[model samples]
Target: ISSLRDRITTLNSRPALDPIRIGLFGSSGAGKSTVLNTILGKHFFLPVSGMHTCTSCQVHVSVCKSRYYEAKIFLLSHEEWKEEVKNLLMLVESRHKNDETDNDLEHAIKALKAIYGEGAEEKSYEDLMKTVPEVTIPPSRVITLKKTEAQDLASELDPYIRNQDGVVNSSPQREQMQLWPLIKQVQVTLPPSDLVPEGVIFVDIPGTGDANKKRDEMWKESILQCTSIWIVADVERAIGARAHEIMVQEAINACQVGKCSDITFVVTKMDKIEVEEYVRNHQGAMGNITQHTAILETKRDLKIRKTRALKEKMMLRLPSDAEVLQKQDMVFTVSAKEYWNFTVLTREETEIPKLRDHIRKLYLDMKRNQLHDYLQEILGVFSLVQAYHSTQLSQDPPMRQEELQSCLSGKIEALKAVTTLCFSQMDGLLLKGVQSARNTHKRNIEKILM
Candidate 1:
């Protein structure tokens, strides 16, 4: 019984961040997906470039001993589904009345029409509210895919991720199934590799450009659970006002003030930045170089200048009151496309490999911390138990009935105090979480409604 009790205590003391969560957040076209692809060494999560994709969160976990790829989908709740349908109906009505075109709204209508037939698009607000059945989304789902069938499966899953029926022949179908909006989250499990650390989950959050209220709330909630965060941004535009606000103003708050160590700022698409003008303007002795040398010299100079500029810009923009900003590493500039394609020789200044190394180190540190915590808990538990056992064993003729009763009473009182304290702490934490979630939901509603 004592052994069983010890095992139970060990299980109870397990750390929450066992599978360390690394969250990725950025605006659309910021190369977040590209960074994700580079990290994974494969294009597992599809990137919806130049467009806002679905707001559903995508979680990628590495599955060991699984030879094939797999996915588990979590759909939105019934209330969320109804809210989406009503919003689409309202959007269509408003757009039609004003003779204004909204591709997103129209795309939604078409997807619904495909799923529920022609009446889906033509239904009035009241009719939709009455006719639409309450959707019962499963708590969890699992899908398996052979290596060869992964791409085909991704195509099938595109509508769910994109929140719209994919384009057909460069034109979207008027009546095609779109399941993306109905999904609250997706879990993609791939075979374990160097890119995916064991017992780590990578989260890809949709850009803030998405207008969905429910999705926005989910995004905020996910941030609270993350152990680390990566803020991906376009290299040229990363220091701009909007990106700065997101990184310095909002993301800092979302990651929790004291708990998080630092936020990693990843400036992506470095290859896209034109350096010809900078090269010509400040070439100095490096001028009159050959085409190859000029390109290399130009890239080198631009990288040094941009890196310094971005660092200075971030230092200026970061809140003086927030000490977390000072702990972060200097900005990392990378071209995921160039790295993936191996078109250009990767330089240390780009820092893609360095980022990977840092992630590995972070994982090791987290595991070491977890092990230390587990050891401390086990040691404390065993020490108390051993001391209690020794006291009982050393008792002369066992204690008298009155003495025993007094000892039992003291122990009971101590246990009661500990239990009460635990419950009180739990209650306070829970209440704070509830309040935070409520505030987040309220803000999302106001943003959407406005």
Candidate 2:
């Protein structure tokens, strides 16, 4: 016990400081709000404005699950289309009517009133009403567009999604990814800030809000600041819808922007979505998302067929190769809470041991630091320089001395920079500890699939 205490004291000496900042973005109904509430272990997001209970850029707040650096990002989605499209149509129609009334002063809507004399405008309108009763107007029939037109649009859009530049193919490729685990990384706080001063501020923005080129740019801008990204993929829809195709691109774009260099896939609401689970077997599960998705397609179920096609063709098309390495960064499968962990964890964060283990894997991966890589580089360089001295002749002392002095000077400068950043002056010399807690949870997802 004494030896254990000494070892524990060594590792636990530092307080968790670097805030793990996470940015959760997805299409509306991707369950961003639900995930937050789950993390908080309660319905802490009742006021998440918008028609879909979305959050709107709420900043540096504490979590309801447990106290920590928390924030919510709210962005609109295609689901808001019902209202926006309606508004756009009304505005266009109103403008058109006003344009017609501006023809001339004499024939203008109001001018006609004077022509009819005093209250003639009202009288004329009443007469018109009598002829075509204003009691109630028939509902405007939605002008159904041609399916051919939609197909044409999709055809034009197909080329963009089919790019095979980085789609995953091999297991090694998937392992190279750093962002895959970020999704599974259980974030009790939106930003991993509970333990670190340098935590991420989540801008829980939905990717669907961007309708045009400009809005798209804004969406990209927001995610670029994230230390990590949790891209929500709906279990029901996955990346099946046309709108989701755009979001898929947005996720790719988030990686492109170099925001945090890590991305996690948040497969949302699996408990309520059936299509993905009947896949009792996937060969590529030993291979990759693409190959396994293909394996899923052979399943006898039609809905699973849709799921397989999307997961294989659409969902992981980007990570077909290069994207797997990105997946290695972070990724997660999450359902809104149906169970509560009344002990130290919140209900939202508690889950079957399998799910918890998967999330733990993601967290361990994301919490990775470049310290090892840095040390390797430093030692390699030092060894090379020393080896050069051993190989060189001491007889050419003058020239060799000067070159050695110059190299030493440069190396010394680099070391100084490293020393300055090592945070030696901080109290108790405790500036370098990362949080590590392995959450073991196991549960079958068969019921959700059924």
Candidate maximizing lDDT:
1
Q: Write the per-residue lDDT of candidate 2 for residues 1-450, one digit (tens) a residue.
A: 455446445445633423344666676556765665555444443223234323322222232333333222222232342343333334334545676432222222222221232343334333532442211211331111112232342232222112112334343422212111111111123222233223333345533543222223444556656656666766656545675565556655665555454555566654442234433344333333342233224222333444344345334534544433434323344545444423322343333333334334444544454344444555665576566666675554455678889999999999998887775665225523211112212223444556
Check candidate 1 and list the clashing pairs: none
Q: Write the per-residue lDDT of candidate 1 for residues 61-103, one digit (tens) a residue.
A: 4545565667666766667767878777777777678887766
Listed in order, each prediction's TM-score against the native is 0.68, 0.40
Off by more than 4 A, model 2: 1-21, 49-53, 58-203, 210-217, 234-236, 256-263, 270-333, 340-359, 380-396, 400-450
Q: List residue ranges in candidate 1 displaced over 4 A.
A: 1-17, 43-45, 51-63, 83-115, 119-153, 163-166, 169-177, 211-218, 255-259, 280-330, 347-350, 394-450
lDDT of each: 0.62, 0.41
Clashes of each: 0, 62
